[model samples]
Target: MFFILLSLFIARVTAEAAAGGEESALLRLSDVPAAQAFIDSSEVTVIGFFETDESRGYKEFLAAVKQIESLSVAVCSEEEVWTKYNITSDTISIFRKADVHQKHLQLSETKKVDSDGLVRFFTINDIHYITEYNQASAVGLFQSEVKTHLLLMSNRDMSDFNQLKERLRALAPKYTGKMLFVLVNGNARVLEYFKLRSRDLPRIAIYDADSDRKWLMPKGEISAERVQNFCDSYLSGDLQKQNEAETSEDKTEL
Candidate 1:
């Protein structure tokens, strides 16, 4: 059932791509099932629910989607699909699986709709399973419902930088929707904030944004097993218990 609906969307996109002479063609979904399939097909999917292809924000959405090639983009004029998703009026929405979030921008409520504004909306919500930390991406990362982040801190110039990144990427799917995997590469300010130096180059840490607390892994080989254990310990409350125990010992000495 799912594949049939998904193929309809793919077939439509393929036809449009051939006609438009561009691979970045926008998908046109005709039914609720097709819309759902498109949303579920990618980590991030943008759907513009409009009355018609000529709807107010439709053109802007089409232009903006061409610039952002990282995810899927579709247009749905089906009233049934809009009702299913609770989309009222002309709206541009993003469905992301990383945190199971839906972000909406209602064109009627906004002063203006342009390609640039639409592009910014997509960029600010472009959260993925494993996202690279940066100024533009930090907004999405910090605002994610999953507040805990597994950070792979390293200098990009290091020999094993890409190796560690791929290792972390391979492990990111395990914690998807529960925690966000972030790669902090060669950022001096971030290193200083974590009290780590370039010599400390490659390290793993679990940072909880809600509590603004961080647990840095002990100095050793950055094996996936060790990193996974560290995350599990934090999730199991063992790390909190260990911190409290150390605090009690400090009080006794004082």
Candidate 2:
């Protein structure tokens, strides 16, 4: 028992050291009074809880977070915070943005997550991650407690995709926490696996995870009004329900 305690203590010390508790980029529970005070005072602040397993992903995570929000990383060593947040894993990341409740980016502490993965994790506002790593993210969407999954599938062009993103951002506030929105690539393997397609540049699709049903937007039309109507119809059960094992082809409207 003494040896076990010693090992734990050593691990904790090592984790803290590796996380650079001294660096201003990372904060500690000991810094909570100040951190919380800052969060309370500031209009926007994002704090990241990083597992202290000498995980090399912190550097990449921190860099990516810097692009959108200034995030301060901390070792997941705070027993009080961990228990309160129900964070039982060593690799989970939590973010509290702009006075809202906390949000989580669940990833593997054991595996290294790339910058693109980190980007996707952060892009998902209050929804599931839209990732292409073996369709795991799509599978995660299917398993999510939320019944709605709004996925944006687009080709290589950024113009149409950007427009759709803007529309999604506008709709996010209206939906609040009722639905999940994710932006996916045009050539995502998950789409192929599900036989979903986007032939005419960009498209929007909805998945009612509860019923295991889906709805695809007709190609070539992506206006805010149309997207809004689609969402409204789904909520009102007015959208066409696609088969569980259906595959649609890419037909050009020439």
Best by lDDT: 1
Error at 248, model 2, angstroms? 19
Best by TM-score: 1
Candidate 1 residue-wise lDDT at 18 = 47
Residue-pair clashes, model 2: 0
How many clashing residue pairs appear in each of the predictions shown?
Answer: 0, 0
Candidate 1 residues 31-88, lDDT tens each?
A: 7767777787788888888897668877777778888877687777778888999987
Candidate 1: C-alpha RMSD after superposition: 2.5
Candidate 2 TM-score to native: 0.52
Give the TM-score of each candidate. Answer: 0.89, 0.52
